[model samples]
Target chain A: MAKTIITLGREYCTGGRYIAKDVARALGIKLYDKELITMAAKNSGLSEEAVAASEKRHTHSLLYSLYTMGNDLPLGDQVFILQSRIIKQLADEGPCVIVGRCGDYVLRDRKDVLRIFVYAPKGWRLAYGKENNMLQAKDEKGIKDEIDKTDRNRASYYNYYTQNRWGDAHNYDLAINATLGHDACVKMILAAAEAKEKAMEG
Target chain B: MAKTIITLGREYCTGGRYIAKDVARALGIKLYDKELITMAAKNSGLSEEAVAASEKRHTHSLLYSLYTMGNDLPLGDQVFILQSRIIKQLADEGPCVIVGRCGDYVLRDRKDVLRIFVYAPKGWRLAYGKENNMLQAKDEKGIKDEIDKTDRNRASYYNYYTQNRWGDAHNYDLAINATLGHDACVKMILAAAEAKEKAMEG
Candidate 1:
């Protein structure tokens, strides 16, 4: 079988990272999430923290340039370019599962690429956050606010960087609600991957 | 409390109809599915069978017009217009769960409308079909071809009548994979509805 890359974009607290891990393990492929930031940081000669922070919401290019004025590279553009190059390199290397950093757009021209978006309903996300020690919400309002803010950042970052809409199903080969549980989401994605492979063969 | 209309579009044999029924019952609201055709048929002065047949694949306006040439009303258009009006009327009346027939597009302008698309992995849909006596595929290939043909027709009908893509997450407030089972799908949608309502309130 030819190499196929799976790019996953996920909502906050959706266990998307965890699910991607399982998919990579099951498919026996490399999983790139935070690792992409590290690789990009190394390639760009910048700190990983700087690249990661650049992904947060409302971090405009002006503020980033002011911080790294002497470096002569806008943090946002630097991160995106380096990450895009790394994603393409990874895809060319072999089959892999890449999580976020607009991997979908980076590999958009590749027919062997499968783009997926993972999201969970608000309540489920809140519960998952609390149980996993990923977030602290005193009440439903707190939970809602945290999710809204994080989702806003993610969506803004995605929309700013990519031509396609962040969570639109038309932009993805598959969009799964991980509220269905990680295992089921994994199975469905695997099935989709298989179907996609078969389609290529035919 | 303001009325909220839940519009559901589903892939064939995904048990979307069953999920919508459970959601309506849980929320104590009216459910509209095939009954829309009956209502549209009565309102359009056409037989329910004719309206239903018009929904089938390859049943183009040209073919339909030949069957009812003297009437001068294409069956597809007649059904769409009447069904759209009925959907809007039902939304205005009160909170309800509407399944298929482009209910999402008909009620697109309403703030209280929650549009959802339900889909399932091929394996799950095939199993559900065999178990529920909805399909009698001799093998996976048969099952796959049947699903592809049915999905193509539904997509065409949806794209023809609606401004939005049928299963796009951007068009719908939520999209789900009923491979998680009917109860889970209902619960997720209910949660989503509650969250949407709360968001509107704030």
Candidate 2:
């Protein structure tokens, strides 16, 4: 069987990972989320935390030498190069669901990939965050703040990597609203995958 | 009555100008299309031909120094400055249907503006273009070719100027398939405008 790669981007606590996992299960393929952090760390010879920190963050310093006289350190450039390598390796290995890390942009030129963005309303995300203890954010206010920061970080990381705006439908093959519920999103992705396969075949 | 701005973007020869006239008549307001070209030229002090040539084309080199040099130079910059002035003037004049030149993006940040994009399929556009003589392009092939080029130019110019991609439903307040017919699009815009007013009032 041929493999299909699906990348999911979601609002904080919108259940993107769960939805992605369901889709992966339906398709009988592996799911990748935090697993990428370990893979990227191992690939780049960097600490997991360091790789995670740089994960969805853009490095914007072409003029860094102006600040450092003799240092050639480039936080952004190094992250981009290492991340590209890891992402390529994953594709080379097998088809899997990738959450965040600007995977859509990273694999833009590839012919055998499907880019998906999952989003929900702020209210839905907040409710989900509150329901689940996964959120370190304490209250509604904290949740809002955290989501905003995460969104901004994700947007910049996507824009920096792709030179295209994130969540813009033009940037992705399919943008699914997870607010319709996680199950619905999974079904949609599965259907979209089949349709994409047919499109490619035709 | 407070003044409002309605920016109409339409596919070639879609009876957009006619529908705009109807809206202006219904609301007892002014309508400007070609008049905008005149205003843009007058406000920015450029020849009509220069304004016409550069009207909806994206040169995309505002911040680049190398591209900014030449005699009678900075055509893009001049068009940019002119667009800004015309948009401001139209908004101030109030309650008008200003067509094209990416007016949607110009009024994107404004609360009092309604942005609409209208499009019809190639066959419909060609039939209308031939009957109306709105396009100088002869024959179906020529008409289709011109439509494709013009639409592309609008998208590129709109994206370049506003940093937002055109034809993305997220960017516009509303998008209309003029294939539903020009009159339907007009009615849709009017309905949308009415809803917007109710929202503002509530």
Candidate 3:
């Protein structure tokens, strides 16, 4: 039998990562984040650094890049295809929580997958970033620039690979605000997941 | 003839107001913001200050507040009812842009209404707040707190009056990132509005 999975797509500094961790723990399911890099590296025969770097920015012109490279696939394409396979394989093996990597689009056809998008207002994210030292930049302007740049890259990557718009609520089973705090967000997601499961059964 | 109205719901510091203004200018339509308070105050027989105060906080009890005050209605109920009427009247009168006041829900049944939600990543919002001096709070933390609190009040007010979840994509015809800058966002909204109009006609 196939296992049910939950795929989370989140905005930067939105507590989406924390929510995924808590949700996975609560549900007693394996959670995949950076681990997907290792899986992709092993599966695609690429180095871990290559897999990790692909997540940083969207590579332009698969055709031009691929033609020049001659048999070496673009890191973005390799990571996406291999990691997508890993995601499917993990789902087939057991219930799991997959964070980011466009898993929502990857598992679009799966009846057992529950896709969620977690987001919050910008002020909340900014405050969280400052309090946690999650940001690389020291000053507020520099920090904001970094956050904006990172968000843009993520959006570009997701848009490049996915059929659905990133962060659009209609693409997911549920969309929540992480600014409500991690515990509250986790409870809400769990409750929503339960509701989705029951609805599927009913 | 009915007007083609666009209602914008947005996150604080997301430049939603600027987008609304630009959209209104592009469409050559009236933009309702503080003006709605004037309309509600005039119609509800409440002072402008009362209407403005009601906008700031969610009224806890309409019936209880009304009963205790003897002659006064709950600010929430009064504002909601009066503003809803004014929204409808504005739409009926001519094409206009309405921001907040749950204008989408207010005109949910109207064929000519276009609902849009504008959002931006948190860091971008903080930057915008700083650059424009739009935030009353001097420090970053204070600004963030005010933004969060104001958002909570807005969400409570919207959720209380509307059948749909505030900020949920399903409730909107279009959801956009204000980080695209005002001009791009305005163009996108205008294009979407035209597409919607064409769909209606076809």
Docking verdict class for candidate 2: incorrect
- Candidate 3 contains a number of clashing pairs equal to 1
Q: In candidate 1, residue A170 scores what lDDT?
A: 54
Interface RMSD of 2: 9.6
Model 2 chain B: lowest-lDDT 10 consecutive positions: B62-71
lDDT of 3 by residue, B25-65 (tens): 87788899856646755766866666666676654444455
Q: Per-prediction TM-score, please?
A: 0.56, 0.53, 0.52
Q: DockQ of candidates 1 onward, in order?
A: 0.11, 0.05, 0.04
- Number of clashing residue pairs in every model? 0, 0, 1
Model 1 lDDT, full chain set: 0.75
Q: List the residue pairs that clash in candidate 1.
A: none
Return model 1's CA RMSD, one decimal: 11.4
- Candidate 3, which segments miss by more than 4 Å at Cα? A1-3, A59-73, B1-202
What share of the reference contacts is kept in model 2? 0.03
Off by over 4 Å in 2: A52-73, B1-202
Output the number of the TM-score-best candidate: 1
- Candidate 2 lDDT over residue span B28-129, tens digit each: 887888566557566567776656655646656444423556445556556665776677677877778788777877776777776766655567678888
Q: Give one digit per residue, the lDDT tens place, for model 2 in A1-202.
A: 4377877776577788888888888888877775664576566676645555565456553234325634554544455557766777787788788877777777777766777776665776778878877578787788789988887887776666566777665455555444445554565566556655655565
